[model samples]
Target chain A: MEYRGAPQATLVDLLDRVLERGLVLDADIVICLAGVPLIGLRLRAALAGMETMTKYGLMQDWDREVRAGAQSLQKGAALLAGQAVQPGLH
Target chain B: MMEDRSQGQVQEQARPEGAGGEAGLYVYCIGPALGGGCCGVTGIEGREVDAVVHRGLSALVHPCPVQPYQTANLEVTASWVQAHHRVVEAAWKQWGTVLPLSFNTIIRPEGGLSAADALRMWLEHEEGALQAKLDALRGKAEYSFQVFWDPVVIGRQVAEASPDVKRLEEEVQSKPRGLAYMYRQRLEKLLREGMEARAAQECRELYGRVARCAERVHVSRPKEGQEGQVMLLNLSCLVSTGMVAALEAEADGLSGREGFSVRFVGPFPPYSFC
Candidate 1:
């Protein structure tokens, strides 16, 4: 097969950091989604504490995260149904 | 509240799968396609898991569409879990080329259909994107390897090698920086160097082993990052169903190496293959 752009390694690197082990919801960030907890543990704590960390740079990329979270929600719903992703602004 | 949801089950009469009343959620990978293989596999809810043909392709689901699982406790969720696993297991049968979605991915309910408008809307918006990704991962699967160190073994070796630190090891019992503390630092450094080197070495060898077998190799951290720099190697191999044996054999061989292990978990939808 014709290899695509950047090496596969590069994309995997980005995905690992972005998707697989990205910020998970933990207690500190125990935000709910419909009712279920959005995240799991440690990162949850940090996200829960995001408001408090406004003084710090933790929330520096807040907007981007919200967008990603929103995307995940819709994608999650569709993925649950095994539907293809709906094209978004992204 | 949970009880109410359980009670309000919009269930249909149980029947053998593909009976038309029983439906299943067939999956591909990160992206969805109009149709694909899905052939010669069993459906897995209660009976045989299979696919219910929709568009031109079949969505793999339980052969017995409706699973009449009689459980001891109405409230207990064991049957639900088992039913879901059944779906997953059947999907795995074809997961090599097809990336099966997580269990319970029915966009439409059994004996139901997707909202046409929403389906169209999503397809219109995301079809290209999904297609792009699907095209990208057309033939590949994810693989990983992790290595760990035995700190005890290192300590034993260190104790044997450096006799000079023996007295210091005895003196600085606890508290502030002492002889024992210093010896530990040396051990840590050695471990770091040794493990990292070992990790790198294994990675190079692995890359070489799967060289022709893979279209691409993605290296990620090992499952254990702190002690071991987990090298997650993702390979996009344009493989035939038959070549799985070759991949498995290679992995099995790698597993016999020192301080390392290999895990083979897919034909899973190539999330990264594309």
Candidate 2:
């Protein structure tokens, strides 16, 4: 039950605050980046390494695609290294 | 065309101050105005952090091109976000309370005004609202509470507690092979429904317990958990600094339960509450 202080807060925690929460202003005077897709995409890519994305059910298809690509690359490396490919490696 | 001309004029009038020629102010958070001095903290992209005061309120900001801080590079974007939080956290420490702005909140010049002037003007206009929020948030901070339940453990508990599930289990054991398969399917469905009901009940109880120790409660969508655990509740609580210990004790009580675990993090800058 001991709470983690701010310094111990994870990147996901920070993202939840800075990206999603915080005081919103009128769009007229502030550079409104709220709906910009590219930034969202990039932030998701950055968070792909974290468990928060999977926890939130975000980018699952993309995550599978990346994992599939990585497995193929690993197989290729194994072939080049003259090692028997493991069946369960996928 | 006449329409295009008017659109162009509008753009000209709203000419983004920081995007091209003039630098706009990227505001981190707002707080009670302190005497003129550097925040002694660096902000996004190592920009010098300072305050723009209007009446009783101050916005901690750094000058930047009016363009939003955007990048395809993950590392760069993460660094920027972390840096933004650092400045806000610093301000929270210095001011005791603040209204933190979201990332990439750049204030641009409008019409013929300078970026600073535009910021000051907006502050003047929003002074009462800003001061009220700051006052309300004084002596308070935000804490995140996530409750994760081990599905296997909870499922077992449900199976033991529900008469319908237990009757099905015994009936399945007594039936022929083919009949048992169908009965097993029904049992699974029944168990699943019971689990869902239990989850909702647990969440409601936990919410009530935490609310007692918080000034405000924000319920967020629960996320999936690792290791076959399911998140039962995701909450952000605005707690008086003095009540943090009580909140933690409540969380500890929940975590001590058989099938549940809790992630308690924060003393954050009341980001969710603001």
| Weakest lDDT window of 10 consecutive positions for candidate 2 chain B | B4-13
- Name the candidate that leads on lDDT: 2
Pairs of residues clashing in candidate 2: B18-B65, B18-B66, B19-B66
What TM-score does chain A of each model score against the native chain A?
0.29, 0.35
Writing each residue's lDDT as its tens digit, candidate 1 over B187-263 gives 55554444344334544666667654655554432332222212234333344455666766776666554433444
| CA lDDT of every candidate | 0.37, 0.74
Q: How would you encode candidate 1's per-residue C-alpha lDDT over A22-69 as one tens digit per residue?
A: 112121111122123112222334344444344433333442344443
lDDT of 2 by residue, B17-135 (tens): 53366468888999999764645789886878978888888888887777776654344555778898998888888888999888888888888887788888899988888898999
DockQ, each predicted model: 0.03, 0.18
> Which ranges in model 2 have alpha carbons more than 4 Å from their true place?
A1-7, A33-38, A45-90, B1-19
Give the C-alpha interface root-mean-square deviation per candidate: 18.0, 14.7
Query: RMSD (Cα, Å) of candidate 1?
Result: 16.1
Fnat, one value per model: 0.00, 0.39
